[model samples]
Target: MTGQDTLETGESVRYISASDLRGFVAALFEEAGLPKEDARTVADNLVCANLRGNDTHGVFRAPTYLERVRNGLYAATPRINVEETAFAARSVDGDNGMGAVVGTRAMQEAISVAGQCGTSLVSIRNSNHYGMAAYYVLQALEHDMVAIAFTNSSPAFPPWGGRKPFFGTSPLAVAVPAGKEQPYVLDMAMSVLARGNVYVAAQAGTSIPPGLALDKDGRPTTDPKALIDGGTMLPFGGVKGAALSMLMDIFGGVLSGAAFAGRVGNPHMDFDRPQNVGHLFMCFRPDLFMPMEVFKSRMDDLVATVKRQPRAEGIDEILIPGEREDRSRRRREKEGIPLSTDVCEKLDAEAAKAGLAQLNTTPAPFAGK
Candidate 1:
């Protein structure tokens, strides 16, 4: 997919086609023992993130995934199992598998069940980082259904009013299909910033915005490295975000019978054991609640009404949550994905370490920057 606008002056970057990036990533995963199809699925989900401006959750994570595979902390050939199944619910055991694989299977199962039962929910355990939650919810949208997803991660934030880290930057995502408008998708972390954003900032040798996190001693700081040095992320809001993060911890971790609070391992560290991350997926067919035709028309009307709102000074137009991402996806699909020089270097190094063919391109440097 094509990237956004060109880089600013003095900004060094390279552009890679989404298809090529996907092939290289899939090859690395395949070399690490994942089935070809599973590798491709994972690659597609990651690359799609880059195409949609979520570089924090995209191929920048390849090195970490490779390291986990090499350490045997992440199972490349996992034996996924369905622990329990009911009319509209299920429990899945990921067997320490990649989050993309486990989440895809669980969401697919939920979609199938929802098709027959009108709604479904699936809980997954023993999964690794699932990349972006949007990837899974979008899957349901493709089937003309509404989807909701939640996942817990390594400890990065503290409980409300506490300094010790006990909660993750848990994420929640929801998506709904539309008739004449882009699907409505909302994907976000409960922390002031996603932990991945701090990693990205560190990679770029940049400081995070003030108030996002604290230093090792619990003093507020902007240094991205603080996140790696036992610092804690601030909640997005004073107490509300912490409440949501805690709720997700209960639903995704405790409810799924997986590791929660500080017990969950970080995928990039603590290689002695798997992350044992947890996820929850829910799907519903709109037709079950209203006629399909009426639902589509109403969604269109709702979108138009929201967009028609008056704009403030300096504002061009009001856009919905997923509109910008949808535009980015379509543009990148025709152009190409942009990767900063540092990210490209990391990916190249990963390819060499994996004994796979490195990207064979003489990237055209961004002009002027």
Candidate 2:
């Protein structure tokens, strides 16, 4: 087929390769003052996000992130320090660094420690937006480790039964490596939708789905603008989702001595102070309970069994966790990733402002599979 699909909101978009997007993003960040290595890290993460079809957490956020770094809010280069350390756990201070950078460092520490200790947990504070939680999960997957990642973000939704926003849309992710099947990767936000999707909608001049968000007055709304302007997002599964959000705040923010209870600065709005976002990363060898080959075989069997189960009416097939995204990534790698016209224009304008080259794009129209 074509590129499987493109543009979540049916907006006009142009397709480009992953390498080109990564280069442009890295160059943009470097021009904005981040170190080359750090910029490349962030670029790779963003491009991976886009390849997985999560444009909300993808390069769509570059402008906002770049602006925050250019302003005094985010440190261009901060000292990532371990505030406390133990054999199997550690607490870190990001020193107001970019969230993705801090998260990458923290997750790397977790993987390194877990390699020797069998398991490791790393908590970090004073960070900014860390993008997709699954990015860290993929890092662990590279090492054949089971991984769990959590992060608390800006206040976007209310607690259960409350009208006013009081909780952050904390995101959670888990990954388990497999031999033949696609690895198990589950990444979800506590809110009905991540606020980044709302930002993306606003960029595309489209409205959000009804029941996904509310205006400031607690009335149901589809207007992304209204949702961002003091509006509130609904929890994914009502109280259950709210309860999980609380856990993320505990593990990522409160337990890490970072901002909690809706105190994390909004990356889109709060410029007076640092986001001080928090993250938790846990990883362990999959063979802790058995041989490595046995674990892999078990995972493959589980996936095969699940895929053999009967499907509902009109269903074509059963997809395990992360399978759809993995499929999207494969298609995008060959056909190219799609960037919305709106986002492209904004990025090009930003690049011109920074005296940098605009996105080097290949013209490929959206042709749904």
Query: By summed lDDT, which 10 consecutive residues of candidate 1 come out lowest?
Result: 1-10
Tens digits of per-residue lDDT, candidate 2, 129-148, equal 98888999999999999999
In the range 1-369, model 1's lDDT, one tens digit per residue, is 122333432236667678898999999999888999999989998998988878789998888887898888888989999855677899999999988999998999999989999999899999989998899999999889999998888888888898877888888999988898766899989987878888877777778889888877889998888767888898898799999999999988999988997788888768888899999999999999889889998999999888899999999989888788878777766666777777777888888877877664334523333
TM-score of every prediction relative to native = 0.95, 0.96
Number of clashes in every candidate structure? 5, 0
Among the numbered candidates, top lDDT falls to 2
Show where candidate 1 strays beyond 4 Å.
Answer: 1-11, 360-369
lDDT values of the candidates? Answer: 0.85, 0.88
TM-score, predicted candidate 2 vs. hidden true structure = 0.96
> After aligning candidate 1 to the native by TM-score, how far in Å is the CA of 241 from where it should be?
0.2
